[model samples]
Target chain A: MLLSGDPPRGRILSAMLATIVAVLAVAPFLFPSTRALAVAERIAILIVLTASYDMLLGYTGIVSFAHTMFFGMGAYGVAIALTRFGAGWGQVVIGALAGMLLAIVVAAIVGLLSLRVRAIFFAMITLAVASFAQILASTMRDWTGGEDGLTFEVPKTLTSAFRLGGGYNGNLVTYYLIFTVAAVLFLFLLRVVNSPMGRVLQAIRENEFRAEALGLRTLWYRTLAGAIAAAAASLAGSLLALQLRYTGPDATLSFSLMVDILLIVVIGGMGTLYGAIVGATIMTMAQYYLQPAMGGLANAFSGVPLMQAVLDPDRWLLWLGLLFIAIVYFFPTGIVGRLRTP
Target chain B: MSEVLLELRGVETRVGRYQILHGVDFAARRGRVTMLLGRNGAGKTTTLRTIMGLWRAGAGSITFAGRRIEALGTPEIARLGIAYVPETMGIFSQLTVRENLLLATGRDGLASDRLDRLFALFPALRERYSVPAGVLSGGQKQMLAIGRAIIEPRSLLVVDEPTKGLAPHVIEVLIEVFRRLKQSETTILLVEQNFRMAVSVGDDVAVMDDGRIVHAGSMADLAADEALQHRLLGLSLAVHQ
Candidate 1:
């Protein structure tokens, strides 16, 4: 067979994935906390975004810095449609399509512009593009709500945080919606990576010139990967806008948001699809919980001045930076890569 | 054997302001091994790359199977049934040997009969089909690279420095394989520094220097005339052996 013949291992991994999905589907009822449900939904959205980044960085061997711009497009698309046109399901769908279309067009343009440049130069160009996008978002306040962002009313049926029936609450409904969309997109990407085409992407990642010599249209494939990734990241941004009911330049188009994605991919290990999910969940949860937990512990041990300084939630990023360095030092392959290593 | 399969007519190529190939004329005859021998920095590799369309020809033309391919992209040139194995062997170290071969064949993949033939040619590859190509020994990696290139039928096979860093036994094995390949319809254009190995398999030979072809003739003629070889290559083929 052309494939390496790892059917048994594939089967076991799929089974494990099914079980994880099953648990996540019922997690709202099991956890019974609105905040917990919120965090889980956020994780789901971030997972989709992070996984999309992996398509470029991991599979296609491209490093892009404009990922969050597309994500911001998604958020803006949904928010602008909801607030200006009204909350009809049809309008939301159109807005999502608009956002995704923008992402694809931008990605294609960027792909074309950077095609002839070296890898590091391409990254710099994307960084410049992302900066330009953020500036545009902030300045074009008429449509995007500028610095304050757009906040719109949702359809009451979806805002059911208090509705009671069939174990479905507003939080649960929102969670399930985000979770389902994320799951479908994630699975689609998984299938894409496992196919024959995925093999070509991986080949390009390993050696672009060799792949080219072997008769592969490396540029077309790289462009395709970038477009797909941008679309998915946009969708994730739309979900984030819905979840927060806010679409601001800071939340969507900021450099920090892009760095967050980079960190998630790096921590999860690039190339492995599941690593994106694992890394998103771990990073999101750490940001959500670790800072406060450390802050509380530091307060309890206030006698030690250094403990308070290092453990302050305001200084949480410093701790995360140190953690990132440690991960790079000890687990260079990342969490999934390290775990898989013999 | 006299029929020209791939022809380069006054092809010029530049890489970042440096002209690597200076108006070169080269050809590979059908069903024959054409050895391209050159010293370091003689633009032998550049000649192969220009044919493959990896480096765009600044001027002139390349014709494969009677169609101009100099202006085409790399994939289009490859799709015209020309396979290239570079000096690096170009094996994807992370992928298993099977995957590498599959990628070479594109969507159709290797057929049973073709795979069987490949296994016969390189038995070590069959033994480690599922192992990552990175772990293969240097000789085995060369075999894998050649196997990937010949996984499907092609009009011409261009190989650069195939015997570089290879041991004597490995070179002998490659020579035998090439000899068998030459008997088939495929035209072979090989670039090599090893005079002995090149002379063993080559039917037609071309010697290159200073970004241009200095000499072209039958391999037997070049092998027999030590004085001519000494004048052209600075060393005779017999001396290297």
Candidate 2:
């Protein structure tokens, strides 16, 4: 019912998703360490971020590099609001709203101007816009904190100093808050893709010409998709800001983060909201754990020079790349797609 | 004669440097099937695209239901009770047959009576209602394309090469489907290469050559005179049959 009639279809897929959600729900108790909590929080945030990107890339069949720019907008909105107006619930609300508004405006403008062009061209235009946003964030120094980024305090209730009774601290409360928001946003996205409007978006994705001939204004729908995706990304960014209490071009506006989002969507499966959850969890876990696991493996192989070198932690990225290639080769439709096929 | 429901007057369309439809003038009467027949590169597809506003007319006018629609967008033109099925079939292979039909309707849900009529015409669509359209055979895809066009009531239906690459039996079925549509009083403008299928369903005919309408008259006249058919189409329809 929460999926709005579009259920995750396969037995394996349903179990995998359920396991991931269950683990995240009890993550604070199951993994208690700060690093573990951080990884879980990142997974929650990335699920929202990647699912939002899927709205454009998977569902709408449009590639946009400017997703991070909107995300950075959200981060900076919260960062700047807390920095200028001071930390409070009201400030968080104002900053999040401002960020979403800005993202929607920019997304509308970019979509209207560039969506009429061919796909590759629109992608290039977004890439250029994203690069420009990055440069602007770096140069704005005073307000944006330039390349160094902005670090500020969250509301007292969300900070680590505020401790509830029963061994629960503010950090735990914050994690749950992020987790809850992510779940709601993800469900909202699922509902959207299942709706009649979502059907039109997929129709446009499959065949724009046919969709137009069918009397749907494809440009209007595409722009709406972009704006909705942007707003969602902004909210995700705001969540990231709340968790880290920091905003930076490197963290939110980096091109690498954009690439990470793309890889997550592909690994989970394109065009399915459930893919976002699966993809983001796998991708974020790998980012946090792969290096440490590789380090331990290298230590165990210390007796063999060649084996140790190959298992070096610094080469985690290479291994990650190889893993991605293997996934693509084996499950060309992506994990969810392959699971659903049979 | 039924009043003209759709008309193209001296419509000119240029695709880059090449002029595809040069002063194409034709009309589809209310409740009649107007077959636009031509050789390869005779601009039959271009004429259909122009009528649907997919391609803008460089110099001319398109009037549908007594309104100038040459300047309108494709969505606007379609919203005016005109449905177009391109030569590609445009089936949206990623979506299920039910979703494909649902997209064609203006309302939230498909009308059961209209859906029953569609299922009656193309039972394969009913059987594969929930399956993705990409799995359907060529003939079934063509059937889905036509079924999508008539999912809702429209004053005019424009389709390009519905029988292309279809089996002989499939063509017979399509001919029957067109006859049923004709009985329902839906105007159809069909661009077809199969002379047999054209003559079977077409009530009116327009012959295009070199981006122009070389001949226009009743389908009976074109079918009755082998000499005129040879003169315009460079072949006799009877010989093809």
Candidate 3:
């Protein structure tokens, strides 16, 4: 922030970054192939989830363990809005925004309750709140569809309305629309991160008392940051529903989801925006491909083939837990931290 | 010869479970340096802090520039032309010299000139504007602190201790800077324990002992009074170490 000697150039760099994203987004439809469309849709989903996590964990210093509550709420909000009302994508977007707004309101009240409590107490409150959210979701089974979850006819016309080589591209149009919104959001967040408001946040992280002494209404500013973080997670909820055509506490929001986000931000570097993307990519790759790939190596080492069976998808949790320990111990600064130091 | 700028009437302060200042009555004149001289534990620092509203003033009031400002916050007190250089310097360590200056925003319209004047006063700051302030030497950091605050709308600059552990040359430069600051229409409240250095720059001096103003008079009177110095500071010229 200091060496740049100019603040306006950040916006320009963000614009350039956005242009690259736009170009990468178009490359999937070079042939309109089904194989390419599936990959694109997956990336779109990941972007929304990761971006929301970044806004909360990176920008704000809350380091929450209950953010997925808002994400789940947003999904349910949209699902209910669409299922009962037969509303279009506009209502879903509004529903998501409403979820975000609701999260903001919740965060404000929660922040007040937790303001005086530093570190451990704050983290504990969030954890309890998230568990409560999941329980509440199941209790409202009449509206939320209980444990079985809710399903709806995917709003085909909204996606098809766009001229992505005209009619019925199935998931391709939906992926493109979500991808575009995510891209815009990414740019918008970048603008916010480099603004005057962002600098004050950084200042707060370095020394909150000093920032408070400077006549900054520290409580209000912190609560506002929390609200913004919740809003981002809520948007992620909306995108999750649209992509999967389903909404449930299990899928849209859960304790594990918040844990995954914590892992992502820790891997990415807590304060940087790009760290979220990096962390998500690292985590997703580990889950999607690493475990199976390790099976061949395990066979060579053990010759018993027990490694693959024992280290299947479920055991990844143990590995993730150990990875977190390693992160806190050996790489306390996270991935981006060491690079930014010099 | 300057007009009165600060009047502390029966000011009292309590920090934590202890009352650190008691009925400390003193006044600083505009465009002149007033030193708060005392031994290490004689509440020299607490007096400066109470003036800036760092600690709550339990009783009495402080009138700065003809306004009662005892109840104001630190930033509010600072905004009213009273720049404080805390004993710790309060230098934003992560920020560069330029960024520290940027954060010390004066009145909305008069900030630009103050920035320019500060750069002109300290040429080294201009050279190392982009470097983080944490990297600067003790003297340079002190200079930056003084430079950052000694600008527009600042009539009183409260310096806790500029030469606490500085070498002789650095101490000389700080004194020169303080002398220069005094000439530029800025009243200064200097708190120091080194009697020689304290008495030289300050036009008026107040000696504090255990939370009370034990003596208050012209700098010349306190500097020349050897009997009082020996009684208060346990220093005798004949048995000087």
Candidate 4:
């Protein structure tokens, strides 16, 4: 498959992706309103977040649920840095690194304890650890601002060119900043996934026993992969705090983030990077369009109770739930996997 | 007289507290094909697993090239110049045949020359070099597995059942590959239950019963001693017209 060129399928996909990204990148300049740019910005962040998780779930086959701890930490780190210390872009990046460090430490403890267990047990352990982090964040009311949350000033230096930090600019600057950061991380993920390390990881996922027998350090590789995922999540978290200009227990350590990321990975595909983008786009758009779309459908199907439930704009989540179930049930490989591989 | 490259002294292994290998003493020497013969559940593969450090040696010492390797992990063991071709073939099925070979052939001497020789030995592999090994024939897969082991700077090539489920022609092809490996002065340890083929390429053989070696001697010696062989192998060596 790697060397095959039976058709122009790859070129077609690449062109399609390039066109979509071009439209996304250029839309803010042409649009009268910045809402579409905001959507793109949020979608780009979700792509990084989901792609990071897919590294383990899709490629490495080490499902982790506690990486949200890193994301939350990253969000809190940059939020606190920008609000308290009046930090700049460099400081925000440093704060993001701190979030990554926090993630690494947590992953180490988790990795050490759970390295021996495979599959579901690993997933449960990571989930438990993440929950613990969330609970701790909520308990620290003074630092995290609990459910109500804390306001943060956008870093004056990062907002310098657009004059956004002084509270004067539009969403365009923020979206571009988020887009650039997410793009860097996305490219980084691409590089890492295609590297030698990635090959070993994919090999480990395929057959761990053979990997161990071949002399690869299975535990270390797994831990490293987990750490990379954590780092990626932290970056997304930092961006989340940046975009909102705030952090709270509700926003920083939300379970919704985890659920949405899961949906993104599942809907897109597990093993491939492009799946993150596919998954994220559908997930982000569901919230934006599902309500309006469902409202229109509900008016058309008044007599049907189940269709009412499915099309209730207030219960758009039900539609999402159905789609998710359908995807997992019908296509075990995922959307990208189903479309791409023979 | 052949040089003994490896020696196992009462090697025992356990998987989740259930003992698989209970004190197996075995040896494979230089420039000779040592065949480990046993029934399916007789711990033949387990013995190979322990020797390669896939499973930890609960009790025993395995010395490879005069160095104690029982404590080492499999990768460390492989780095010590021992290559294992497992029963599952250990072919990275998702990767192309060439990628699989490259990963296994890590820094081994005369690599290009060895690769050329291996490709020559298995032309089917060369033809399907870019294809995933998952699609290859069982015999071709077996040949690829052996060829992978041979491409390395091999001190010992421990193969777990190279002839498992191959056609007569495929087995014949594998035997030729094994013969070529022998000519390269590489020591080969084969795990086999196929009586005829096992006896053919094998210089020495160990009959394993219930995780222990019941008999170990030169193949010719066992071929001549019908009564002793029948007692250990539970098979008659005599040909019937």
Chain B TM-score, all predictions listed: 0.97, 0.98, 0.91, 0.94
User: What is residue A197's positional error in candidate 3, in angstroms?
Assistant: 2.0
Candidate 2 chain B lowest-lDDT run of ten: B99-108
- Residue B9 Cα positional deviation in candidate 3, in Å, after optimal superposition: 3.6
What is model 3's DockQ versus the real complex?
0.30
Better of 1 and 4 by lDDT: 1
Q: Write the per-residue lDDT of candidate 2 for residues B1-241, one digit (tens) a residue.
A: 8999998899999998988888989898999999999999999999998888888899989999999999999999999999999999989998888888989985568999999999999988899999999999999999999999999888999999999999999999999999999888889999999998889899999999999999999999999999998998888977889
Residue-level lDDT tens digits of model 3 in A1-342:
331222222444345434545644784556366544544554555555665666555665666777788778778878887887775766776777777788889988887788558857888998899888889888888888988888875576544444545544546666666777666665556666555566556656666554544444556766776776677667767777887778988886777677777777777667666555456656765666565555556656575567656655556667766766876677576665544443
Candidate 4's residue-wise lDDT over A1-342, tens digit each?
Answer: 321222213554456456656766776666536466567767888888888888888778888877677888888888767666675777787777887788877777788779779789999988888888888887877777776666777755434355644443546677777888887897788667766677777778888877776667788888888888888888898988888777887665777778888888988878878778777887887877788998999989988989887678998877778888998888687777766643
For A86-190, candidate 1 gives per-residue lDDT tens digits of 976777788889999999999998998796588999999999999999888888989998889899976555786558688776766677789999988987787
lDDT of each: 0.86, 0.93, 0.71, 0.79
As for DockQ, the candidate ahead, 1 or 4, is: 1
lDDT of 3 at A191: 61
- Deviation in Å, model 4, residue A224 alpha carbon: 1.3
For model 1, residues B1-241, the per-residue Cα lDDT tens digits are 3789988889899999899888899888888999998889999999999999889999988998899999999988888898999999999998889999999888736799999989988999999898899999999999999999999998889999988999999999998899889877568999988888888889999888988999999999999999988988888876788
- Among these predicted structures, which one has the highest DockQ? 2
Cα error, residue A31 of model 1, in Å, equals 2.6
lDDT per residue for candidate 3 within B1-241, as digits (tens), equals 6778999989898889999888999999988889898888788788887887778789988999999989987667776777777777767776677666655652222366776777767777878888898999887888887776675456778888888787888887877777777777578899976666776688898888888898888987766778987877776433431
DockQ preference between candidates 1 and 3, better one = 1
Best-performing candidate as measured by lDDT: 2
Docking class of 2: high
Candidate 4 error regions (>4 Å):
A1-16, A30-32, A157-170, A298-310, B105-111, B238-241
- Report, for all candidates in order, the number of backbone clashes: 2, 0, 0, 2
